[model samples]
Target chain A: MKLYLGVAKDIVVKRTIDRRDQKRVLGNLYDYDVVIKYEIENFKDQPVILDLAESMRALRSEIGVNNQRDVEWELVADSTLTDKLDEKKSTADQAVFHVSLPLRGKDDKAVKQTHTIHLRIKNEW
Target chain B: MKLNGILTLTLALLATMPTAAKNVDLSTIPPRDTVQLTIYNSEDLTLVRETRTVTFKKGVNPLQFSWANTLIDPSSVDLRFKTHAGELELLDTTFPHDKPQMLYWAVRSEMDGDAELEVTYFTSGISWSADYVCISDPAEELMSFDGFVRITNNSGEDYADAQVRMVVGTINLVEKVRELAQRGLVSRDEAKDYERSRRKAGAFKADAKNELLSKLRADFAMAENAARQPKKIVKEGLSEYFIFSVEGTETMKNGWSKRMRLFQGHNVPFRIQYRYRPQEYGEQLVRMFLLRNDTVSRLGSTPLPDGVVRLYRDNGRDGLSFSIEQQIKYVPIGQEIELNLGRDPEVIHEWVSIRSWRNAFWFRRHGASVYYAPGKGHRIKINDAVVGWDEHQAWVERIRNYRDKPIDLQIRRSFDGHVVFRSNLEPSLNDYRSPQLTAQVEAGEKKELRYELVFHQGHNQKQTNVTLESVN
Candidate 1:
């Protein structure tokens, strides 16, 4: 089983190539890049942060390996979004992210996974 | 050849008829021309009679009747071609083998035309009850009573422009109407029992009808001798039962209730009294409105069905105000009905004097010196063994009349145990059954009734046995 630390989604870019023998090179390819943009908050300790960063690097290497398009990733930790999530958790409210999944094609390229998490805290003290 | 063509045309017309030998479409039955409901309130039974016009063929006509999803008792269905009975003859009725809820009727008509058919059957879940409202005068001696009949229909059927009749009596129903309607759900033994009971009910119905017919004939003979008058309610006596036919037709929809005025009597004579029965009602002085159901008292033609009767008192205004509103029970015909109107706070009665005394003829326990005998040195031995003891109780009841007019206050004072009583106030009718005192008190008058009661203890106080001699 391949271990993944973050959600992977497809990013599609439609292009018209002007290369010499572009027609022979199959310009209208329906492939997509496996891009990952992950946000994590309130790590609680340094070990949790280190483990999450290491999982992210492992996820990047394993994803889009047997595919045509190249894979990319970006991680935003302890940002304003994470601070807002922490504030909502302290005030006993719900904090969640709304994410749409990517569509997959028959090409032996990008495979994606999506995950959603909801957090609620009863009291701050 | 033309005659054969005419015969072929007639055969084709008969074959093409849509309603022949098939499930009757409900829409083809046509609207009811007249409908009547005879509701027996004692049982959850209503006999419905409906008349509708149907077109029949020249020779044989098959008519289908279906009552699906309704609470109609299929066994009691009866149909008759009321009009054109001589021309339209009912041959036979057959229940289809496949459809459980439909029955077909074969009628032979001499000529093809429109004929009216009357269908009657018994259905459950329709009920009616009588209610009354009475307003008393200031003196509480006269009242105005209004009786209303409330009819409720929940038999899953709608009855429009139906003439309603209410029966008032005990109808002995062994099996419930709903059970009979769903007879297939019952066991075979239960169905046998139901059949026996249904036969009994049929016999009772026939007897009641015969009695009613004889009574009506007698009444008609009596009517010729007496003055003929218009009766608002067409009441008929069915031996042990009485039925009242309401005047106008009413539209009774499914799951709906409607109340109509049955009768109203003005200046009905009544009496207001106070009663106190400690053994029954506990320290409350219940006020009662008493009335007689007779012609002299303004109400007596039929036996009143068991229902609610409300009473109200006018608050000295001409036709404007009323107080002391209370609901009571139904008053049967020709009987004196007593309606309790709760407690009376105005004309109050309380214990003003209470005196209890021990009779000197019997000895009672009095402290430690009870066994001491004079000159006998504690060997207190009487010639005859002490039999029993007696206690006499006395009381003086005071009643203050606060009403502006004189009121006849009847008081009933009951005791918990047996007592021999005598009073200064003369009981209207003195008997061992129920002794009561009646007093006519003027306005703002305070009257007192003194009475004495002697309680007896039995003589068999001890059984003779051998005693140990001075063991202590």
Candidate 2:
């Protein structure tokens, strides 16, 4: 484990669940049994920012992933109210701050990593 | 050297691997100006479409300004579509939020003059969603539970849409408090117990005041929001009205709307109108309480209890008597609670007659007039309000004190608290033993003032309600 501070690469998914609405309660709450889906990168060492809640897909098992070049993701948002997030793109508007995998002693230090952050608010009207 | 070569070869293979493809179809779908579609389970899959043109009544005429309630730009659809016998118009899914894709054509038949409108585009996932939110009974007066639904359209895919799901709730401000409470950050000793209990683990404070404060914060947060905005139940089928059936758990958010979160708070029932936004167009709620047992009291005195928002009033023996005659309950949830607007039967109010002589004089001086002096430099106050004004007349002979002085005053009062006095002059007697005149007021809350004036002429007296109500 090394204190590698490139972007401190973070993704904040802010979500606000307003239960005060009748339509929201019946349509959105009734479905999914209220279990929010999250992929979390659950790396035990990695944390995901809560921004685009719709992107989180709970892990059924584990998918084959390339260690060197892959996107790191997380679902970090409180379940009920709106989740606040630090601005994602530090470099630009689409700037998503994220840490890269092979985050360790990969001899391929010259290899660059690319990641995309999506924002989605799937709520009742 | 061989190991390095192997690593390079592996990297090249991974980069060249094929990616999954998303299908797109746009037949029989809603006409929309711009469409944005994204699925959580699968990615690299997105659809954006917009309406381009609309045909008119006849003559192959085309109309502009066509938009869809849900359809996105079709010409820009990314997924490929195959009709029963043919492929659809190829769409480039590039623009994310803008760009028109397809056109809605309303064409009249050249052979029969009949008309047909057609929308051509491509979209995947033959499914869409409809959401419903509900509230059973607000009149019942319980913190309500709202419900929501997510309708998944299976235009013709497979696998039951993996059990379509939708979550409903709000963001609450309780997070900070909760976090602080959990961290044992509350300063007050009482806050400790509350903090401890709320947390699953015991590393919290075990105090009541702190707990009460925390509870108050959560409760008030809910109430303030409830009062300002309608509780929103966001999901499918939100625009139209429907009977929302509560099929699962209920929750709420007590944080800043943008920061609200959900937690199990109340249970929901099926069939209620989900309020997406609270109604903000109403006056401050006025609650009324009536005095049931205590029927009549003094005249023009404390007739009803405090906060008794009376829409109507009737003349009583002493003054005015108000009561709830209609079905208007401010808070009607549990048991039948009764409150009276009339004076409490046990509350005693007393008023003295400064000049109403015993039999003969009292009868004769009825409605008699008084002349207050201008030298008084005072204004008569009824409920602390200045109503009438006069600069000259002092006394109507020994019977009345004329409107003379203008009293400049400021008053602060509560709803149940009222001060009714003549706005002009109070009869000033040089005699030291003037039989100290006074009136007693009791029992009534809520949060206000009344104005009146009195004229005394030895044993013949008359009182006129003057103005000038002031509040501070």
Clash pairs, candidate 1, are none
What would the per-residue lDDT of candidate 2 be over residues B1-472, giving only the tens digit for each residue? 1111110100011111121111112222222322222211121111211222221122222122222322222222122221211212321112112212112221221232222222222223322222112112322222222112233322121221121112111122222222331232223322222223234333332243234334433433333322222344212221111111122222111110111121112322211110101122122111222222111211111111112222222232343333333322322122222322222222222221211101111111123343222235433222121112211111111111111321111121111111123333332222221211122122232111222322232323333322223333
Q: What does candidate 1's lDDT look like per residue over B139-200, in tens digits?
A: 66789978888999888777878777787777655555566566532222322222343344
Q: Score the docking of each candidate (DockQ).
A: 0.00, 0.00
TM-score of chain A of 2: 0.19
TM-score to native of every candidate shown: 0.59, 0.15
Candidate 2 per-residue lDDT, tens place, A3-35, comes to 755643333222232222122221111111122
How much lDDT does each candidate structure score?
A: 0.55, 0.23
If you assessed candidate 2 against the hidden native complex, which CAPRI class would it receive? incorrect
The worst-scoring run of ten residues by lDDT in candidate 2 chain B lies at B4-13
